[model samples]
Target: MEVTLLLEATENAFRIMEKARAHALGVLDTAVQFTGEQTRFMEEKRWQVLFAGAQRRKTRFQNFVGTALILFAFWMLLSGHFDPFHLTLGAICCIITAYLFHDLLFANVRVGDMRVVALRFLCYIPWLIQQIVLSNLHVASVVLRRKMPINPQIITFKTKLETDISSITLANSITLTPGTITMDIRDGVYYVHALDQKVADDLNAGEMEDRVAHIFMEADHLYVEDVLDAARIYDALRV
Candidate 1:
């Protein structure tokens, strides 16, 4: 009789413990879901605010001024003319160009900072060029081989870039690199045609993606306004 009573009590305790564990798991799932929804909502709200500002019809005078200066500099570089007559004509042309294409000028209000982005992008250019040279040499070696071991395949991957400009930059960089070409980009995904396993593996390794993301501040920025410094860390890691 005592054994039967103990068994019943133990079974009841086991059932209660199982029910408690299930209830705890349910609460945790609900908390996680809530956190995810909140994060998404915040992201959407931030994007909405940025887009609203971009859509405003007011003429951005800063864009006009910056564009005019760049045009003037390019004109001087091409013409090498600094006399009054030439300078006047160059200014006129710059003004006209700025008037017509001011909207296309670099404006990154969404980024909340432009100088950091620009500096990081400039640093990325040299790295990309170096990659191009290395890739070209590799492809040349493959071509020179008697067997011609060229195995082409399309590699597709998703990116975390928040803006179209970043995506376009990444696409162009891939196309510029030898042994690989950007086939297409749709909905934050990129399709690249790689000449061989080496090229495909390099893309899959995501060094370039991380570089572009860093340039755009897609990753965490523990040190503000120190993009070049951050790049140095990455460079060291790569080495």
Candidate 2:
């Protein structure tokens, strides 16, 4: 009878141990799944944070000033109203527009010194105008010719321009020039329709791209140098 009782107790203890082991395994599995989910969430959050920081880094107060000036100038140029009441109204409208849409207007504004960027852009305008005139003359000559030399074709080229503003500027410049139109821009690739081979050749040469790149490159280099200098100064102070 005692041997029988001992066998029964041993069986019960073994069953209890098995149940406990199964429960422990379930708990571990749940913990591992929960940990994995949290890790993924954290990774996503980190990317969001990094994206936000980059966006912040690309914009500045100077962007607002630049946007306001451009808007006001455009308004004045269009309205051509110099009267006090009209001027006041235009100014108010420009301020409101600038306040509301400055970020969008200067979405890729350099975080560097605005004065240098403005000056460089101003210098680029005259050269762009010259190109437009030359293009216009070419297009006119083609149109007036007895036999049309028109050979319409679409050309696609990838650019290394890092800023949305620079890419957009290049696209607009292409559109402004005669015989070539910017059809679409995606993933740093430009789709352009050329009226003739000359336009295609000019675009393929990438002069406009180089000019736009120059506008931003010097400012970006200076900005990076400024940041590095600031960091060094801070470190020296700490020491």
Can you tell me which runs of candidate 2 are displaced by over 4 Å? 1-99, 218-239
Model 2 per-residue lDDT tens digits across residues 27-76: 65566676786665665566567656644543444455657777878888
* Residue 133 CA displacement from its true place in model 2, Å: 0.9
Q: Write the per-residue lDDT of candidate 1 for residues 49-70, one digit (tens) a residue.
A: 7546643522355566668887
Best by TM-score: 1
Q: Cα lDDT of all candidates, in order?
A: 0.75, 0.73
Best by lDDT: 1
TM-score per candidate:
0.66, 0.56
Runs with alpha carbons beyond 4 Å of true place in candidate 1: 1-59, 107-109, 221-239
